[model samples]
Target: MGFLLVLGPLVTLHELGHYLVGRWCGVRADAFSIGFGKELFGITDKRGTRWKISALPLGGYVQFAGDMNPASQPSEEWLALPEQERAKTFQAQPLWQRALIVAAGPVTNLLIAIGILAAFNFAYGKLNIPPVIALVQEDSAAAKAGLDIGDRVIAVNGDPIESFDELRDIVVPNPGTDVDLTVEREGAQKEYSFTIPTLVEQDRFGNEFQVGRLGVGSSPGEIIAVGPVEAITLAFKQTGDIMVMMVQGVWQIITGRRPVDELGGPIKIAKYSGEQLSLGWRQFVSFAALISINLAFINLLPIPALDGGHLAFYAAEALRRKPASARSQEWAFRLGIAFVLSLMVFVTVNDVISLPIFGS
Candidate 1:
């Protein structure tokens, strides 16, 4: 129920983008639906748009005028109509307008993420953890470099260290390399230099990688409140940071630094959702935000049977000054469906293997 609640809002927001943009572009939306298949209940709005709640809560759509055909082809009746009559037809719209309408869905997801983060920040304030060294391993890089516990990290090289996250970001990739660390101890501040060891560690999916380690951890700090502007700025920065992490994770998987088992299916998501629900609403919201971002990013990939796929075709049409053949389009769609199904199967297998579902 919690998963559905979170997912429903995200999905509706995404489709709402399409509907709103379509209407703004003078493309009549026949149905602004919250779900798929048979309608449970609906109302025809003043603008003649059928707003519907359907059986499937997983996703939704905005069916446009002149989209009666299965292939969404422009009907002869539409084509034969006067310019004023055809103005509302999606096919009759300029390419840029069509592209904007299509792009709006993903853009809406991003905006939602930003809004959620900003609201959360404003309500709960930002928790800024200072980079104070809490532990140092015996004979490790920090120990050998004469760095003691309780040393507060002020900066790395020339970059100011606001938090441990920032410190980790600067230090993680450059293993076995010297870095300048500005530290504060007692009443005095001094610069301490150290070379991080190439410590090998396994990822969440059990693939190993060598990363820089000074064998020290940081102390946690108290939460501090900020104004609306700072909160929004932090929200955007957090979003960008998450995007960077996602890109790095993908690159790691591609480079065999992480296992493909890290890739999850619906089963994994359900398990995570349940676990996160137990943790409380904040954690659940965070998870949902990350999932929202992932959804937006994945939909933007140039794969067939997706919004990006349609956009790609539109681009090709714009370039060639002609649409692809119907047969070619059909074949591409079929291939895309097959690819998606195969990927689902593979990820499902991974999810099952990773969990104790088959255990007695």
Candidate 2:
């Protein structure tokens, strides 16, 4: 599956974060796997960690010695280990150290994304697309607001705009909402406040969604090369901007502004992965970068059976000076696993139904 291809490397790197951090905190890993199911090939490293590739290519995990299994249930062998060996176990580590190990996974995913985007910007430079309007649609929001071709967008919501994409970064998500836009025409700057209309558009992949349309288009703009330092700065801002948009998008979906069906799971990702592959290496890499950030954000959520969830427990441990009872942790993890599995099943079925073959 296309999702598996992207998921393999991303997930492996995620687990690697846990493995490396655990080792740094004096915790030993039982295994560092690249995938799930039966092991295909494996070798015990010098550190005595079994590193392996598994049959399923979807995702992976790192198992720390003396730590509870995925279900938060303790392992018998882990419990049976002598006190000296158990001292180096993940469960025996200081609470802060345990927290660091869990946090490392999501942080590493974010780092991978930043590195990828930084490389692209440093190499190809960023497109310098000015906000100069080349076309205006009649009976649209811009037309209604007396916007004309040749008008250049200077600011949106009082924030100065650097590129047309920046203008879009403000407007696209605000469908049917009023915004304050400043434009320059004939050497004079004027402000136009208008309400954007909902524009329902379909992509080449047959996904349909509604977004705010400004009713203005621009011709191809120049590409401006930047020095290494500036490229990294821009890359950071770009990555941060996209992350904010993602969080906003989720909020919109929860508030009923975006469709519930638009919530994608693995199936949608697999389809997009294939499409990106056909587009060329650049687009495929971009997709992977986006997925990387998505993975980081998702894992950081305070849900049960997730890194964020573990971090939440650590936070509690810090306050109480003691960990939660074993029974409570077990119950919490069990409920978290059930919720995650049910959500996956629901989304996978939604993905199948949304396929073009179904015509639903």
Candidate 3:
């Protein structure tokens, strides 16, 4: 229930971006349903789009007028529509407009994340921990970088580091990559370069990943209030940082550098949502923002049956001066749906196994 509440808003906002942009581009939508299957209730606006909640309560979709179904397949009848009616269909739009409509959904998710993060930073300023080393793991990145106790980290890769957490945000995603560190010790600042080793570690749930280990600890730090400008600025930076981490995580898993088991589905998200809700609204909002960012990034993957997939087709359309043959598109979407459903089943099974009732 908690997960649905969080997910509903994010999903709705994403679809809304598509609907609004499609309208702006003169495309007519047949239905805007917040779930699949039977409709709970709906209303057709003057523009003739049916907006409703569906029984499924899982995810929502926008059915364009010329689309054969929810997957946005261009129908033969749609192709044979009268020239006058074709003007209002999605296929009639120019390549740029079609691409914009398809991309709007993911972009909306990103904007939602930035807004939530900026609000949090403005209301309660983010903490900036001092980069004073408290503990260092032997043979870790910090150890090889010649860092020691009482050494204060000044910068990473020539970028000035203001907090320990900031330093981590830069290092955590770049395992097996070299990082330059400048530290202050004994009244002198010196630079050291070291590689972040790819260390495999497991979470409490036994999900493993290859992560860059700094092998250092720090004390609690003070906080400073950020002005409106800086808050928004930091919010964008934070969003980009999360996006980078998500991309790296996906790449690592695909390349066999990280465990595939770490990939989570709805169940793990629901559990985390419940935990965050228990902590309070702030934590839950942060989690939702993270999820929104992840949704945006994931949807941008060039897989068929997703927004990115649609964009890929549009790219081909632009290049070839025509859309891919309907038969080819159909096959691509079929394979894509099969792959997605299989992944969902696998993740759901993992989620069940990770349940406390089954032994966490």
Candidate 3 error regions (>4 Å): 69-74, 134-146, 154-162, 173-212
Measured by TM-score, how close is model 3 to the native structure?
A: 0.87
- Across 1-360, the per-residue lDDT of candidate 1 in tens digits comes to 666757788888899988889889999888888877899999998878899999967578888887654334576767787888688878788888888888899888888888889989999998877798888989888888778988888889977877987888766865666899988889788887867677778744443556788888877778899899999999899888777777776776777765687788777777777777777889888888887887787677677766787788889989999888867876887787688779889998988887765551
Candidate 2 lDDT for residue 159: 88
Using all chains and alpha carbons, the TM-scores for the candidates as numbered come to: 0.77, 0.90, 0.87
Write down the RMSD of candidate 2 (Cα, Å).
Answer: 2.5
Lowest lDDT block of 10, candidate 3: 202-211
Which candidate achieves the best TM-score against the true structure? 2
Better of 1 and 3 by TM-score: 3
Worst 10 residues of 1 by lDDT: 202-211
Q: In model 1, which residue pairs have backbone atoms overlapping below 3 Å?
A: none
- Candidate 2 residues 120-196, lDDT tens each? 99899989888889999988789989999999999988989878888887889878678999999999999999887
**What total of clashing residue pairs does each candidate reach?**
0, 0, 0
Tell me the tens digit of each residue's lDDT in model 3 across 88-178.
9887788899899999999999999999999989999989789989888897767776789989999999999878998888777778778
Candidate achieving higher TM-score, 1 or 2: 2
* 2 against 3, candidate with superior TM-score: 2
